[model samples]
Structures are given as structure tokens and as C-alpha cells.
Target: MDQFDWKQLLNPEFYILLELGGIKIGLYVVLFIVFAETGLLAGFFLPGDSLLFLCGIYSEALMKEFSTGSDFLNVTFLAASISVMGILGNMLGYWFGSKSGTYLYKREDSFFFKKKYLFQSKDFFEKYGGKAVVFARFLPIFRTFAPVIAGIVAMDKKKFMFYNILGSILWSYVMIFAGHYLHKLFLSQFNIDLTHYIEFIVIGIVLVTTIPVLMKLLKKKA
Candidate 1:
């Protein structure tokens, strides 16, 4: 049998921290990534779904590597940390939106300021109201921009917080846990080595998640 190429097996795009041998650094990196992706405007281009899933897979590997007996506790901590990071990011985004609402309103469409996107976000917010915060969590680009739009429209802070926390908890738990458990499942059932294929799986997951959004755009264009 041939030896597995650990270096070549890992996904270059997804294994940023692991490739660097920075498990400890990965935690902080994941936290910061979550914060930026959720809070900052530039985060619109960051990997959200696939990254969270990969983080879950990485968490599982880290637990095994450290020989941590506290599997449940570790999972809880990972989920909680990501959930908090996402929530805090949304809060920062809301603050920026509130402060910049007028500024953004007067600005014309350009590379960064696409009036259509703002309109789409506004329409989504208006259509869903507070629930948009929760629903947006499942979306890709919309998830990043939803909170900003909420603040731009001056959504009730208390209401936004309620939905924000709930959405963050649900989103973080679903993606991370799914990744973690799915890794366990495949390894156990198929006797497959996850390290060799996890990258491809993550890519497939991203494509799947993006399908609905792409379809929506296609329909609009049609």
C-alpha cells in the first residue's frame, strides 16, 4: 500500500492554519475570521460555510492530537467560541452600519457600493423584518450584509440582538457540528481516511450552498 501524502492531501484553500502547524494559532485565527466575516464589509468575500465546516473537522483532529478526554467539553467550547465570535462580529457590523447609514445612502454605486446589493439587502430585511437576521445565517453573502442593513434601517437593537444571538448559535452549531460528526461518520462507516478527502468534501459543500443563491441571481437576470 502507498503511504498517504498528508501535505498534498490537505486542501490548500481550507487548511490555512493546519498547513502552518498552528493549531493553537488556528483557534485565534478562526475567532478573528469569524469576527471579520460577520462584521466587516470586506468579509463578504471570506469563506463562511466551508470555513466553519472545516473548523469543525479541525477541532475534532485537534482533540485527538491533544489526547483530550473532554470531547464533549471541547466541542462545546469550540461551538460557543465560534457562536460568540459571530455574534460580536454582527454587533460591530451593526455599529458601523448605524454610523455610516447616511454616508452610504448618499454614495453612488461603484466597485464597493453596489446600489443593487443594498437594495436587495434592504428588501430582504423589510420582507423578513427581524427574522431576516435568523434566516440570513443560512445564506452566503446575505448573511454578512444583513446586520449592516438592519442597522442602516435602524432595526430595534433589542430585536436585532435577539435574532442575532439565536441565528449565530444555530448557524455555528449546525455547520461546525455537522462537519465534526460527518468526519467521524465517514471514517467509522466507510473506513475512509478523512484527511485525504475532507478538502474535496468542503469544496462540494460550498458549491452546494452557493447553488440556491446562484439560482436566484439567474432567475433575476432571466
Candidate 2:
């Protein structure tokens, strides 16, 4: 393995993920990130979509760290585990938002907290109603704050949870499975290994996921 590169930390692939080494640690880090990105305000900057996609591509390695099961079992376990974390993370966000109330809106921007993102999430939630929880799961910054917005708006707990569970499962499974199966398909058909070109893959994923959010924000501003 190459010496740990501090510069790689800037890349979402290496951003507080696996830098410490060990597949087991990597799995735990992935769970933590899933939780933090949804649960904590400071987690808004974390890579949610791209990371989940990468998890799919590297599903085998991550799964082996936890279980020696068959391929189906491994992928199932990985997706299920991530889904649970995502649900829990959103729950925490909802809880925090409920407790904090309007204080979050009044809270000035800081390194970790961005007022604009919060407002953006509020607008998304208003537009989508309760469904924002589900739709926001696929979007980056919105996913981080949607749950909080749900709570802030005092959305019904049962409604919030229904969307939360649905969104988390769908998001986690889709991203992970997409990466894993695509990697398998390419390797089997063309003998191409995606892991070798992870940088390009990460950039592509980021752009695909984020560009829409940027355009939406810009359009709203205009």
C-alpha cells in the first residue's frame, strides 16, 4: 500500500475515510459519516451520495470486514446497515431541529453552519411537503438539512418517519448497488476495474449529484 497521503484528505474518497487504515475501520467510518451527515449540522459538508456509490464499488472489501458470507449476503448486509444508519441520522436531525426551533434560522453562519443551506432545505421541504424527506435523500446539501426542516416545521412524527425510512433505504441501496453492480459488469465484460479510476468516478458522481442542486439554487436566486 502507498504511504498515507495527507493531500488525499481533500478528496471525498479520502475525506476522513480509511485514512487510519483497516477495512473494519473503514466500515465504521462509513457508518459514522452516514449518521453525521444527516444527524448533525456540521455534517452538511460530508460526502453522502458519492460515498455511498463508492461503497457499492468497494462493497466486497467492506463487506468482508464484517462478514464472510456469500456475495448476496454481503451486499445485502452492507446496504441494510447503511440504511439503518441513514435512518438513525435523520432521526437525530429531526430531534435536534425540534428542540432548537427557530434558533437555527437565527443562528449566524459559521464554518460548519450555513444559514443559506438551512433556508434552502426549508424551501425544499415547503415545496415537497413531507415528501422532501424522501426526495432530499438523493440530493446532497438538502439531505443534510431536510430532516431538520421537517422537525422545525413540526411535521407529524409518523409522517416524517415514513418518509425517512423510505428515503434512507432507497438512497443507500440504490447508490451502493449501482456502484457494485456496475463495477462487476464492467470488469466481467471488459476487464476494467473501477477501483483504478476511482478519482474520475468520484468526480463524476459529485458533479451528477450536485449540479442539479447548484442550478436550482441559482435559479432561485435569479
Candidate 3:
């Protein structure tokens, strides 16, 4: 048996603080997560919608300034911007996977990167078609690597890019806006900074949103 350090596991509260910090830092983390998750296997677990939603919810609380989305870097615009980041990340992932999968893997491994989960993601991409690009954006444990795998398998580049852009924007914006509007609808009671809850809650929703897959994983592990 191996001893797993629990502290190594992501602390949900860290994400909460990131959310409560406001737009600039919040958006920075969101963009980083989106880019890294799709850009490289090593970053698959980085926070996404949970943080983004929190950003939307708590945009007023942060201590920085920026201008982008609706009425001053609103969630809509934040989502849209990060969506582009995700797409670009996927593009880089694809190129890396297609042209230098092994070399890239080896290089990353030299730095202690683990990609055990990405194998499953690759299989999912194989089983599904280009739809994986769009739909995978909403699936945990699969969304991060599906596009990269598409490149490994030599999926059509132009077509993959189209789906990639559409899905990245749709997924990123959907989660951020959902948090924004949902909180706006109930600010009196449920009001909290969206980012504070999003990096974890939104991710939980995305994961739970595809419960069947999770159940299968649980069953397999069992």
C-alpha cells in the first residue's frame, strides 16, 4: 500500500478565496485553468467553472481593475475570453500530442508529470467523434484531454477547431453566466461571491452533471 498525502489533494477553500478576490485575479486564475487543462495533461485538475462562477458572483469584491465583459468585465465577457483561452490551449495540446506525443510526454514526465487519467480521456475521444470536442468540455476527467487526443488520432484540424471554439465558448460562458444569473435571482438569500463557490461547486456540477460516467468509474474502482 502507498501513503497518499491528503494535503496534496486540492483544498476547496483555496479556490473559495480565489473566487472572493474579484475579477482581475479571478479571471487570471480562470484563464490559467482553462489554458492549462486543455494545453497539457499535467494541468487537467485545475479549477474551471467553479472559479469562473465565483468570479461572476463576486466581481464587485476583488481589489483590481479591468474592462472587458458586460458593464465592466462582467461574467459574460470573462467567460467569452477564457473560452478563447481554452480553445487555444486545445490547439496547442493537439499540436503537441500529434507531432510529439512521446517526446512531450517524456519531457513532462522528466518534471514529474502524471498522465494516468489522460489515457481514459484518449479512449473517450476515440469512441466519440468530433462531438467529443464540444461535449467533452462539459465532462470531467475527459474534457481536458479530449481535444489533445483528437490531435493524436489525427482528427480533422479545421473541423476540430470549429467544434473546439464552439464548445469552449459554450461551456465556459454557460457555467459563468449560470452562476451570475442564478445568484442574481436569489442574492438576498444565496448571495455569495460566485468565484468563491464556482471553482468547486461548478466543477462539482460538471462532474455530477455526468453522473453516469462517474458511477461507472466508481464501479470499476470497486
Candidate 4:
């Protein structure tokens, strides 16, 4: 791999992975991004799914940054850590929505805020009700706003938390483990290194996750 390029900092893939400025805090950065992406409205553009997948690919290395655990333990720790961040993020988002009420709807759109995304989340929440908390976990923008929407409508707290915990674990573990095991499988069986193809992998994950969101938005427009 080439030396970490400053220019790559502008790229979401590198940014989310904390490959900038020779920073070794990949784990902390990943956790914070997970939290922001799930909890903060401005974090809608952050690369949540791709970040999780990349973390999987780099699981062992990331673990070594903090521990000498076995491979399985490393991946589990990474996934569990990320899951906790995601859960907390959703809780914060819910709290924000519950306290803010209709303020978000009336708030003007800035560079980081888009009213359409909020409305889309609203539609998704209305259509799926409580299930949106779970379903939105896989979708990009929806995942960021679903909890907030639930909070806005004052959805039952216990029910919201049940779905929140369920969704966070499912989403985090699936993405992270898929990356970890797939990377191991390909390297061991096919002699292929996924790190070299990280860009393509990131792009593929983004498209797969975002296409549904785009289609939903388009369908609504039509």
C-alpha cells in the first residue's frame, strides 16, 4: 500500500478508516464515526457500512493496536465495540429528536442538513412503524434518521430500544464479520488480498446499500 496520502483524506473511504495524517487511532475513529453516522444528522454522509466492512478486513491489525488477542477474539471485539457505538448513537439521535420535536422539520437545510432525507426517513418510519428501526439499520441515510424519526413521533421507549439494540448488533456484526472472514477466506483459499481491492469493495458496498435508498426516493418523486 502506498504511503497514506494527504489527498486521500478527502475521500470518505480513507477518512472513515482513519488513514489520514499517520493517525494510529483507527479503532477510536471508527467507533466515533459509527456513533456520529447513526446519531447525528450531519453525519448522514459518513461511510457507515463501508467503514464496518473495512474494519472487518483490517480486524486483526486493528486489534493489535490495542491487544494480542486471537483472530476470532479480535474480530469479535471490533464488532462488539462498533455495535456499542452504534447503539449509543441511536440513543442520542432519539434523545435529540424527542427533545427537538418539529424543530428539525422547520430547520433550514445547510451543507450538512437535507430536509428531503428527513422526510424520507419519516416516510420509512410511517410505512414500517417500529420495524423501521430494524429495517433502517441496513440502509444508509435511513439508518441515520430512523431513530430520530421514532423519537420525533414519541415512539415507545422500550420498544425503540429493543429494536435499536437488535438492529445495531445485526448490522455491525454482519458487515464486520463478512469483511473479516471473507478476507481470510480469499487470502487462504484463492491467494487474493482484499486490501488491494479495498476501493472497489467500498464502492460495491456503498452502491448495494444506497441503491435502495435512491430507488425509494425516486419512487416517492414519481
TM-score of each model, in listed order: 0.83, 0.92, 0.74, 0.92
lDDT per residue for candidate 2 within 1-222, as digits (tens), equals: 678776764465674246353334678888988998888765667778888888888777676656756887788889999999999999999999999958988988898889989988888899999889999999888998999998888999999999999999999999988988999999999999998998898889889988989999889989
The C-alpha stretches of model 1 lying farther than 4 A from their native spots are 1-23, 61-68, 105-115
Residues 149-215 of candidate 4: C-alpha lDDT, one tens digit per residue: 9999999999999999999999989999999999999999999999999889878998999899888
Please report the TM-score between candidate 3 and the true structure. Answer: 0.74
Model 3: lDDT of residue 51: 54
60 Cα displacement, candidate 2 (Å): 1.7
Candidate 2: list runs displaced more than 4 Å.
1-7, 15-23
How are the candidates ranked when ordered by TM-score, highest leading? 2, 4, 1, 3
Residue pair clashes in candidate 4: none
Whose TM-score is greatest here?
A: 2
As for lDDT, the candidate ahead, 2 or 3, is 2
* Prediction 2 TM-score vs. true: 0.92
Candidate 4 local lDDT, residue 27: 80
